[model samples]
Target: MSPKRPIKPGASNTSPDTPFNLPDVGPPALHRLPLNIAPQGEGRIPVDHLRTPVQSPPSHHAPLEIVDLPAETHITSVVVHAPIEHFFLAPNQLSRLPAPNALSGIRELGTQKHFVDLQEGGTVLLGIDSENHFRARLNSDSRPSGPRLERVEGTLTWRVKPSDESVGGSDSRLTLKRLRNPDDGPQEVVAPKRSSTSTGDGWSDPWKKWDSPPQQSSIDGIEVDGTRFLLLPRGTDPDHPIVYIKNPEHRVYDFDYMERILGTDLMQQPRGAIRVPPANQWEVDPNLPFQYPLKQYIATYFPLLSDTSLNKVARHQFGLANDGDMATDVGLTRLRQTFNDWKRGNSTPHPPLADPLLMLPTLATSISGSGLSRTLELPTLTPEGSLQRLDFDLTRQEWDYFKTTHSGADLKRLMASILNRQGYDVFTPTPSHYSPALVFRRKNHSFVFFISLHRVSKGRTIHQPLNSGPDAADARLNTQVGYPALQEMLQAHAENRLVWLKGGSQVHNSQSDSIFIVRDNDSRLGTLANL
Candidate 1:
């Protein structure tokens, strides 16, 4: 016999005359559970044995506050706005840039932009708009600069997926913790590609190479700026993986302009300066003094370091030296350390720590180093390109080993143990009452969990669409309807109830598009508390 359908309040199923009624949960709660559906009494009809209609709650008992949702809530829609401008400084060019002053009405600009001096301090301008437009003197520096103004507008649409699609053959291996439908359509996979590969000649942003080899079939894209741009999977491609221009009418030169606007002298420098060269080749060094750190380097030299790429000069010129003794490089090390401190919220804006470019590599290195494991084992399907089948049973010893390795150290030891025994990966963003998450990702799908610590009422709410963009509509529907339905299903399964509990959720709003699962009820209290 076919499995009986689960009842969801207020949800309109496709089947005609379906007996289920959409439950009137309560008011619009952001990031919290919306329903107050009580547990069925002992005399209540078993879902499968049901014959009578499900009764609706009275007009009262609605919640006053929003209940937070499980960490696994998948956000479906997101909107991102990027302001990019680009320009090429010729023998003669002059223009003013948007002035930024944080002390007064000019606060932080959303995702700041920079004015790059392509040449060595060769650019010049004498004006900026503060509370009012005023003449400002450009600082003298070793790097070249030029006067130029370039503008471009665009929007970016992106999605994150599990595994590097290109590296993990279609039929890779998967360490299954949950059973899901096999034919649930093609799962989105992230195809990893090496962005900057030096072919012994020079550094290559493969995505930019006109004749770049296609690393993976899955790495694809649509024409947005009148050109076909391939989207490489994150962690594998350039730091900014999802890139495209909204206006195709503008020439590709605009992309160059945008590139100049986004590129910071701090991030890009002559490759030779950063790495040591072979015996046969000439080292690309501009021989600039003390290689002023990125902040001071950009400020003094290419004061417009935040703007664009400098000359294709030498190694020392760019301060990208590989002397292997950064430990003693006072100028370089100090700049890197200052930036690291700022990114970690350890310190405020100090005189020398204004620009982040100076300390970026160190900051990123720190984040990468903060993890518990030296190597993380991601589940694969088959070594070849094909869908993988579960060979190991949940009770088997192999499954236990897989669990302990993947589950990191956290407060929920019992849950961690159970999860390991079950062959699942568990994690939480922030662990506390006000914190809204306890997620799980298995076989590339996400699941989110929400719990009410207090039987009387304490809990969090899940907001819909999960974004604060202009495009989101009636925030209540996405958060209220979508989240509760999925959460209720996952919560039911965690209680050991036998019912259909499918895949996981995606968090649309995070620096890294994180995969998650729902975990409800604090495991510390041995028994399942009253819902």
Candidate 2:
């Protein structure tokens, strides 16, 4: 006998209608177990014998999918009652319509022909016919949408009706068409040249130089060198071009060049002597001069002695000179005491008082002895029949040194000295400010100047006011902290007074400074005058 086998449901070994059965087992009496006795009336089952069923989460919704559509061409139309002249006057208004981009938007490409080219995104060519109708065609095979097309044709019809009693001007209807593929024409067409000029063709012919360099040939009376004409635009349009001649060659001319050319004086003064107004005057009140000892000092010092003479006097009094070695100590002591007393506004102890050599009477006598009389006389030409040439070689060297070595304060002093010598009353505020460093008054006219010295970089040698932060644009002197000074200067200028800004050299090693006179209409100091 074979080993006993277990049976499965619905197998060939078992009948389909037979009841499901378990395998052979031991007697029920042997498998039974005794339960523990609980207290009477309790209603609880054993927790270890119980089991819970497992559960799964609910299903989720699926995500969305995207789709793309093809681009479409758009067409728009408009109707208006306006004169043809009005449309011509403002042709730019037509470009405002919704259309493709243009190569050269609404520009006149031809002269007097009323022929204008309207390119559509570099792919279509449109032109205005003689009847004022718009004709358009695809200049290339490419289309904005779908596959490459063979051709495209479109028309913009402008139907106009004459003005009547009802309408103020002409009535016109403008109809535009949507671009579409055409069936009859060839593909890959080239755009027609919009302009007949060589420039309009996008490039020039290499052989065209034989015709006198194009547009310049039309210019009459002026001879143009090849290089010069090539640099300029080739057209008759009135665009002003400025040509700068840098480092021009110096031309040598004979002494009689002017005489040979004109045979007479190029400039002649009037027969009568032109009398100029006096520059110098008693700036301080002559009657009340005693109040200003400083003014007295200036007057006494200027006319009596040169700077060299003053230096000599100082050296002698200080015992620094060889000649002063023989002087007595008591005499030197007395001289020093007298000078100190005079400076303190007290009378000198010496009988002669202030140096007799510095007295006005003695100065006048010395001037007479030098053959310069008190009487004023006009200057005449020298015995050589030519005006005496001023020797400026030494002056030029001194100027160079002064420019390089002097500080801003030194420049201010120099300017003040020059103005005072020219008979102008120069004044500086007690508390000095950077802007408007000096003021000058001559008769009724007054002027002010802002002085500056800035370093140059990158080979730029000219001082530009706007290049400095404090003097540029919104930070200009007029807008700076000391606006009152600028206002005063502007007011003086408005009243026909001179206003200037003195700019020192821009180079570190140079001393070429300038005085820029400000103009009335502009913020810029227009002209640069040499200092």
Candidate 3:
């Protein structure tokens, strides 16, 4: 039996079977403005009809839904709000928010569709994307250093609440539910939703679009840049190992980009943003079930990290033509998923290359190092493995708290703790309001991290220090690493106070290599060099 199509709840005359459309706002849909009034209605789909489908409906794509917001119709104008506290941070999941700055926009509660404003002037953006995680899932493969995939002795449920929650059926039902971050992070607890329901379950998907994601490399019509977003392999598409799709256009890469492909603005991804790097055919690793590369240029330029942010200038170079030519965005499941699809029309399968390094030189069969040589250990480099590495640093509780915190001081302290654990002799000097700083010594090297943390968790920007100098005492940063508010970082040789403050343990300024550590609020860290 086919599943029932959902329609917005509306007037008594509206049929439950008929799908509903939102009343059109002015020009292209900006999704920025908040609805002054919500349409009140009820949806009653018979349970038997919903249960008719034998395969799992992938409604909502598990947290992040793959929706292409057209240029003219997508980006919305939203008022940026400060970080709201995660309820778990409160004594008993009870949180108190300060006075409302302003109601920004309606946000979907259960899915990753919430548009956020990290600051007063921040604009929310969207685009189309694809991911490829060419993973080797052979059960026989094992790594003693890697985490074992076994059941744990604990469970955590948590979620982030956009101020004006867009209605969702799944979250609206449960009074107390265990929830998790979209990625493999900690979980938290939340109250029942305003869109109340008694029928939703762990298996339920109000936005069921697919039961399981396709295994094939999905080519998207577009991509975005200037923002970062993580893409974990969701599912597979074995039927079409290589595919070219002008997949729903306007696929935004960041979980946010362009002023035109941006919010409240009617436009496609900006043409002047950035350009993609050149592609090399040998990058594809065909030894696996799917087509992907063991060592590729795509991952090199992008850097193996926690996001799928593509720059607008970087598109159209990967064998793509037409407006949606570079279809590397819809990739799911592996490295090949993202770029292999982009190379589709021009890419072909090649046999695995066999090369070996005999450490024993193959002279003596019974040599002690006879079996020392091993094939490239590629599992650790897999996309799945790359994302899992982040799970090591945080729990559901800590990660959620980090997101909602407005205290730069909190970030400084957290940074201190993390470094201390990593064998750094951390000395915590009092942190300032905007320009918080931390100093530590590892071995002979002593350094200061002119640190800037996101004012809000995972917001696009980190809070840089004021442009004022030490001459302006009060406005100057307490621990002057020496950068204006606009300057990215203060170098090691640029006036050394931190090391001297550490009981006169100052080393040569250049030897310190005082660095800039920035937390993007996305559970990822970055550095700024002073070259």
The candidates, ranked best first by TM-score, are 3, 2, 1
- RMSD (Cα, Å) of model 1: 34.0
List lDDT for all candidates, in order: 0.24, 0.26, 0.25
TM-score, one value per model: 0.17, 0.20, 0.20
Question: Predicted candidate 3: what Cα RMSD to the true structure?
Answer: 26.3
Write one digit per residue (lDDT tens) for candidate 3, span 267-312: 1221111122232111111111111112222222222112211221
User: How close is each model in CA RMSD to the real structure?
Assistant: 34.0, 46.7, 26.3
Q: What local lDDT score does residue 284 receive in model 3, on the 0 to 100 scale?
A: 14
Q: Which pairs clash in model 2?
A: none
Question: Top model by TM-score, which number?
Answer: 3
Off by over 4 Å in 1: 1-525, 529-531
Best by lDDT: 2
TM-score of structure candidate 3: 0.20
lDDT of 2 by residue, 1-531 (tens): 101111111112223343222211110000001111111111211111101011123223122222221233121122221111111211222243343224423233243222222111111224443444443222221211101112223422222222122322323222222122244244333222211111100011111121234554453212222222112111222232211111011111122231121112111100001111252211110011011111122223223233333333333332321123322223323433443343343444442223312211110111233332221111221223322111111246545765675355555555455445434455553233343255454432233333332322224322233223322533344433234555555566566544433322232224332221111212243312100
State the lDDT of candidate 1 residue by residue for 1-531, as single tens digits. Answer: 101111110112123443222111111110101112223321111111111112234333322221343344332211111101101212112223333233221212244323322111222222243323222122331111211122111211111112122322232222111122345454333222232211211111111222212452234443322334332222222332122211122222221332232232211211111112232221122221121223222222222221212221111222332122221223232333333332232442332133221222210011124332121111222223221111111234533443344232222333334434333444432333221223333322223333211111111122211123324422321232244443543464475431211112122332211121222223222212311
